[model samples]
Target: MKDHTGKPVYFDEEFREISLMLLKAKTRWQIDQLKQYADEAIIFIDEPILSALGSSSYLGVSETETARLLKELIDVIKNEGGISGIHCCGNADWPMAIKCGPDIINFDAYDYAGTLALYPEEFRGFLEKGGYLAWGIVPTSEAIAGENPESIRKRFEQGVEKLSLHIPKDLILSNIMLTPSCGTGTRTVEETIKVFQLLMRLKEEYA
Candidate 1:
């Protein structure tokens, strides 16, 4: 195992390999199981096997490995008739996620809105397809947990303006979905509740 500092805190290559295999198996299993559930519309395969690092931190498989794993996972989702997505709140390789064949890319647009907007060509191309862009607009970080719906809504609206300049309004509206900057596991209960409520309000008002 390794920490964010990129230092090896633990050394067990054999166990690590086994763990990866188990994760791949479990992901495949969940993809299969999720397909069996009629109410399910999406299946997000969590690929944290290599991301033993933090969630937002930049980390992913090598090119060859990424292609292989993504192809297999995407195939599973396609066969199951479910929309696939990947949620990486922390910084990540957006291009790699796009190449993973996910129908949607869940990212923290609220924080790095400018970075994505800069790639108009690629962003437009992704939107031109039936792909969705799930924006994590709600602020969940402890430093800014006091955010309200109005504040979050404005943040998203600004992002929309940036994205709309490159992609058509109808296209952006049809495909955009709102979410929190990250999970609430690290937040207080009140903040977590506010996050969902704020998200709902934003969706309702905007949609």
Candidate 2:
């Protein structure tokens, strides 16, 4: 890969190609599962690397190309009668991701809720077009120990309020879906259970 200055950058194109191949295979398998067993499917493309798009380490990464790649996969899912979502567990260029046209955007609302609010116009358009926001309010880290249902609800409301500055409060509220800040793979089973328990309680009390 080359940067804007025409200097070669470190990017393993072969690895990227293999990763895309794997992603496509997984996506197709999920679509087949939906067709065979369920009436609907929601597939989220977990893209943690997206958070590093504009960072110094990945300065040569092309936003346009990234969006095209994401859109390509999302379109395949959508065309196959599945709902496509993108989950980025850290702060990223919200506008660029929004423009990729996924049915949902899963974000780490527990930590980076305010980061998304910085791109009001993009969000407004996304919401108005029947898009959904998967608010990752339940923290998956050690912080989950300190949070209760009410506290998490309060934090979620704060995030909604921030976005409501540009979009209608009701619109934002109605379109929101709750999730953990990220996967609980690294957490203990006890902590993982606590995360889901809190998630259900928060949904029952507030959602």
All candidates: TM-score: 0.77, 0.89
Those runs of model 1 whose alpha carbons end farther than 4 Å from true positions after fitting are: 1-21, 31-37, 46-61
Estimate, for each residue in 31-147, the C-alpha lDDT of model 1 and write its tens digit.
Answer: 678666665557665543333342454343245555565667666666666678877765565666677678887777777776676667766788777788888888778745667
lDDT of 2 at 50: 92
lDDT against the true structure, each candidate: 0.70, 0.87
Model 2, residue 98: distance off in Å is 1.2
Identify the leading candidate in terms of lDDT: 2
**Per-residue lDDT value at 67 in model 1:** 54
Query: RMSD, each candidate, Å?
Result: 4.7, 4.1
Candidate 1 TM-score versus the reference: 0.77
Q: Residue 78: error of model 2 in Å? A: 0.9
- The prediction achieving the highest TM-score against the true structure is 2
Model 2 residue 26 CA deviation in Å:
2.3
